[model samples]
Target: MAIKKKRQPKTLAAGRPPVFHPRPKSISRKSTKSLINQHHLLEKRKRQAIAKGDKAAETAIEAEIEELGGIERYQQASLQGQRHDRGGDSSKTLMEWFKPCFAEGQAAPDRPLRMLEVGALSTQNVCSKSGHFEIERIDLNSQEEGILQQDFMARPLPRDDTERFDVISLSLVLNFVPDPRERGNMLLRTTQFLCGPERHSSTWSLRDFFPSLFLVLPAPCVANSRYMDEDRLIAIMESLGYAKAASKTTHRLVYYLWRRESKCLGPESPFPKKEIRSGSSRNNFAVVLG
Candidate 1:
């Protein structure tokens, strides 16, 4: 529950995003946490079973997950927890970070910034407010109206300028992926949907704010994982041509704004699984490329 906030300056230094995670005083929080953990554990096991070519094990795991009320139940619980978290929505943090950089309508006089929200829990978050962004929300399972029920990976690749977005949010998403390599692939895939470097708002007040990624993850994924830390995560992002625009760390979450500075070197066979830290209780969270 003690986190050394590495960088809370620039885009996101002052605000505290829901510290509801890791605190066990309330029954609701404990049950939600346990449910999420169970889902994650089962998902990991299913991945492992598939890797070993054990169809029987995979089938059994799927049945177990179904008995636990399936993926829909897990997603609903997550969405509910986000709504109930004491520290408001994650979009609030994303909006705060951009506010300091872009002067709203001034930056884009003709139109609003385009944003793609992956694993979107709701269509009613603060980000959906008019005049700032033309937002598109996508989740694998839709809990409500307006949010597209689709898998981000399977979503059609943009064929023209109209489909690409200025900003893409992977909020509390990448960590949900069971495979580290798949996580890396997912990160790479986002770049393709983002408007190219030419579309970056250079003349705007906060140059290069567009064509950026707003990423949020549970603190443990980076802070306490055996294979990942802030440094490692930054290195991976840098290799993908994203420079750290701003960062903030809370008791339960860490937030980042990765400005897509240079053109990404897409999909190189690099960033293999390497243990950067070792401990008894560290989680096996990693993002391996290729």
Candidate 2:
């Protein structure tokens, strides 16, 4: 046993211990500082890209930050506050008040009440929300994108099918048509389309058209592109066999609620007369003599 003695491992120069080796603390500190500097450089570059309006570069940075799970922090730092105000006298407004009254008594729920809108953009949202009707819009130009595809004056209505609608809303449409006769014809045609041939035994007549109609027109007194006085419009409607039930005129627009009648009741028509009422906040008017 005493023939050979084993040798121990070589120790450090300090001779403090053989197992321990002190790390280069400066290297570790330098590496951590490098990482922090790299992060700051990246954020600065992203800001510069955005400031320069380089969309692609900005997108790339956003994507990289998102992948690194820093999207929420980026959004919080970049986003700004927006302000909105929803306060006013809503009741006194004409269209705002008229909508609820029309939706009161109706039949179909599943299949929306079909409406033909003329000279206006797709009134689907307006009609559906206010009157609860599905709008089939027809304008002068091909403007309304999806709802219906056609111009009112340019093309004749498709009469091959017998499908009909419950309501027809001609809002701010007739004024655009220059010819009063054509306007009258358009009004009559609208009624004919809504009341399909199958519904009646005899040929379509203006007297037996729409039971109820909403006509929103501009005042003739106003000097605008499409403005007609109340008397002239009433005469035209009367000629087309529409007896006005209610009418109201504001500063810009005139609204008429008409119904088709069986027979003409002498020359003296029942179209409502306009009455103006002044309000402190806003002017109010009523149609009393229909």
Candidate 3:
């Protein structure tokens, strides 16, 4: 028997098959475009944060971008182009501050002072003029032959006490750390390289830290009402038993020189600030300089 033919799907007026469009395909394109736009927005914000020396903001933005699956692009973009010198020979010029120590025979003149430059992009023979400093450079984005690639924050201390440095320079380094507690930890970590007490000790004597810490902070952040202002930083260092030796402000940067103070404080000095309380005790202890 001739049964009724099943109803056929309708075609276009021209008798051509209807074009099939997957809803997901269009939705995916729209979502991709949205993410790209968001990526761009985050990038712009990150740049602004860097320019403003707002490291916390930059870090937060980075975390957001990473969550959006754009970390690879961000990393590639960050590594592109020739690395430029952040702060010039000013650091070298400042080396003169320590000259008195050498001239007075407090420190050995024969052996060049061992200096560690953290976050270094280009080698600055700051100590070359006097042949007084033997510099070791390290950076997170090392692209050169001599600079050791490392995240100064996460890297472990030298196993041997003798391997520690006589001086450590953090030139625009702390600001790059995303967490305020981590930034404080970076300050505390400086003691690891400084000519100080044994690293293994749970507590450190204030007198043990003999190495000088040279720091360069962004001028805007130092002067403005930011989370990492100069005053706050000075307080943190003071809490750590570091007394300011000299401070100067360049057109765009703030230079600080600190020496470990001889003053002794009871175990309970200035307590750890809020940011540090939740972090590793090493960080908290470092901040307290106990």
Candidates in order have lDDT scores of 0.82, 0.48, 0.60
Candidates ranked by TM-score: 1, 3, 2
> Which of 1 and 2 is the better model by lDDT?
1
Candidate scoring better on lDDT of 1 and 3: 1
Q: Is candidate 1 or candidate 2 better by TM-score?
A: 1
- Model 2 residue 28 CA deviation in Å: 65
Task: List residue ranges in candidate 1 displaced over 4 A.
Answer: 1-27, 101-105, 206-208, 267-269
lDDT of candidate 3 at residue 171, scale 0 to 100:
70
Candidate 1: tens digits of C-alpha lDDT, residues 31-84: 777888899899999999999999999999999999877987787668666764
The best candidate in terms of lDDT: 1
Q: State, as a TM-score between 0 and 1, how close model 3 is to the true structure.
A: 0.57
C-alpha root-mean-square deviation, each candidate: 15.0, 23.1, 17.9
Q: 183-229, model 2: which lDDT tens digit per residue?
A: 54566666555543233223233123334467775453222322234
How well does each candidate superpose onto the true structure, as a TM-score?
A: 0.85, 0.44, 0.57
**Prediction 1 global C-alpha lDDT:** 0.82
Q: On residues 1-290, what C-alpha lDDT tens digit does candidate 3 reach at each position?
A: 99998988865665876688853212233354366447656766897799899999999998998887664443233222112343345566456676555554343433445778886655545564566677888887675678898888777778865677767888766655544456666777777667653231232322223367888765754554323455666777877667787888877668888875533232245434434223222221122223
User: Could you tell me the lDDT of residue 268 within candidate 3?
Assistant: 44
